[model samples]
Target: MAVRMEELRDHEAVRAVNRAAFGGGHGETVAELVAALRRDDPGALSLVAEEDGEVVGHIMFSRTLLDAPRELVPVQTLSPLGILPQWQGRGLGTALIRAGLDEMGERGVPLVFLEGDPRYYSRSGFEPAAGLGFRKPSLRIPDAAFQVFRLPAYETWMTGTLVYSDTFWRYDCVGLR
Candidate 1:
């Protein structure tokens, strides 16, 4: 029931949790992307929820960008937030998200964005990004699925196309068009 950030040594367990949580190619993508992000940005955080020695949930926040009308601004993105099927509905995922967002906010991250189920993310203060002047690169994303959350005072920084890390492009989450 306790959730906290995992150290680098616990990396494999985090991948295993992602594998079980998403159950497909997405898991593989999660594992690969996690590794690349850590290698590229040691400042990135990979979080997990551990219960009785097992990792039941996982989430990641790393450097990303907002491509505004004429320039790119640094931002951090929330991605691959997953709770193992057996652990779903227990609120571990929500706790992981709240913790990650709070940690980022306290550290002065101006904004955070994600692509996820609106019904779920909305409860955590996320609203459709397009409503905030942001756009998803892929049209496959439903309007309701792309969302952003900015501290009330920093909402101005959330606009424009989200540019994920190069790993995203390598894996086709970006530059796919």
Candidate 2:
């Protein structure tokens, strides 16, 4: 399948993809989070991968602040990356991630954070956030799963405790940690 990436404008399609991709007790929560982020975080970047005019995958990056003692470093975090179960292993997820990162970098985003498998995300240059003085804002997340990818505009002084938007916590999604 030829996957085309674009900003997610079809809320219904995106919701369906999220529900199917993360199906379980957590699927609806993630889908709700996407809707909440759309309303609460205007600066958030939400993209979808489409094939044959249908959304097959989705990824989101919401604007956040790293509360360093001296300054609030602006950054974004990757969350709720999803690909249809049937579409898994076809590189759609990877393509969505790469496209999101490139767009963030072009927009001058300094860093990107995510909580996921290091074995999978490491392929995209993500490294342990702790190693770079970045601390998880919540204790619920494991240190090993919390990773960061520094963009071209990243600076050494951008390290600090991450602060996510209320939408993340309200939805009780991955951002809770």
TM-score of each: 0.90, 0.93
lDDT, candidate 1, equals 0.81
Candidate 2 regions exceeding 4 Å error are 1-9, 175-177
Tens-digit lDDT track of model 1 for 17-68: 8787867887787778777878887888778898998888888898888888
Return the number of clashes found in candidate 1: 0
Residue 76 alpha-carbon offset, candidate 1, angstroms: 1.2
Evaluate all candidate structures by whole-model CA lDDT and list the values in order. 0.81, 0.85
Q: In angstroms, how far off is 7's CA in candidate 2?
A: 5.8
Task: For candidate 1, list the clashing residue pairs, or say none.
Answer: none
Residue-pair clashes per prediction, in order, are: 0, 0
* Regions of model 1 farther than 4 Å from truth: 152-158, 174-177
The window of 10 residues in a row where model 1 has the poorest summed lDDT is 168-177
